[model samples]
Target chain A: DAGVTQSPTHLIKTRGQQVTLRCSPKSGHDTVSWYQQALGQGPQFIFQYYEEEERQRGNFPDRFSGHQFPNYSSELNVNALLLGDSALYLCASNPTAFTYEQYFGPGTRLTVT
Target chain B: EDQVTQSPEALRLQEGESSSLNCSYTVSGLRGLFWYRQDPGKGPEFLFTLYSAGEEKEKERLKATLTKKESFLHITAPKPEDSATYLCAVRGTGGFKTIFGAGTRLFVKA
Candidate 1:
């Protein structure tokens, strides 16, 4: 069985540009969540998607958004990126909304220059 | 606000050393507590989940124990391969969002 997978393992963007990162959840999982991890820090929640709708969001600003396709794949979009936006983006999936256990992907490293 | 706090930003130990990492949390109602191990530049790998106080879970040489307000991840006879940043997180009964602590970086030297 395939585990969670993410696309574009690494990315470089200029300030004020936009970037899109993709994620495919682990097989048999339906709920997808995104997180941001800065260097030397634990991940911070970004948002969660279930049934193609965003269910919960963190304290991040509107510049960050995401989409979940029917196949349980997800995409995270960041607009007007700033240097602070540079971090590792992680995608996690669980079997259901009620399940707290999550499997995480390798993550996408975003570098905003 | 729900919060999670981990202690000892970093630790260094010799091989076969036994040590413990701490994670203290405060939330409305605890749904579950989680422990994860993360390698450099990689996403976190799930370790254990504790649902209630007094719950304990063991895997390999790592053991996790929970209390009303804190959790402990105890490593027994750790090796260099066990070195990584251990993260602690909590989910509340009110919502699906999980809060994570800053994590403790463990370095086991051979």
Candidate 2:
């Protein structure tokens, strides 16, 4: 079965610009979660979506938002990006909202200049 | 405050050398501990999960053990293929989010 897949493996954006990253969850999975990983740091949870609605969120600011479609695909959008926003954006999926294991995608590296 | 800390920011060993990575955590309520392996510029791959104290899980040459306060990933007879950053995370009591550690970078030289 195909695992979680993300689009535009790598991207470069300018400061003050907005960017949107896409993620397709693993087959048979329904819950999708977003995370941001800075260099040398572990991924910090951004938000989680289930049943096309956001169910949980992390400590990130309001500039970070996401949407999950009926097909269980997700999109992560960051507005007014700062250089600090440059990092690896990851997407994870689980079969259930309360599942113990989360399968992660390869992630998209966002570089802000 | 909830926090997860991993020891040994980086480690280098010979092909046959073995070592252990530590993950220390303190959360409001402990639900589970998770381990992941990540390569350069890639997302993490799940390794193992420990639900309770004194529990252990193994996959190939990698063995993971857990306690109430900390968890360990022991590598046996490591190989160059084992080179990657090992990350540890814990599921929060809320059941909605997870807390992650900074991770330990391991490099196996042949």
Model 1, range B8-83, lDDT digits (tens) per residue? 8999999998999999999999989999999998889999999999999999999999999999999999999999
After superposition, candidate 1 runs with Cα above 4 Å error: none
Cα lDDT computed for each candidate against the true fold: 0.96, 0.93
Residue A70 displacement in candidate 1 (angstroms): 0.8
Residue A111, model 1, lDDT: 96
Query: TM-score (0 to 1) for chain A, all models?
Result: 0.99, 0.98
Best by TM-score: 1
> Per-residue lDDT of B73-99 in model 2, one digit per residue for the tens?
999999999999999999868658888
Prediction-by-prediction clash tally: 0, 0
lDDT of 1 by residue, A42-110 (tens): 899999999999999999999999999999899999999999999999999998988998999999999
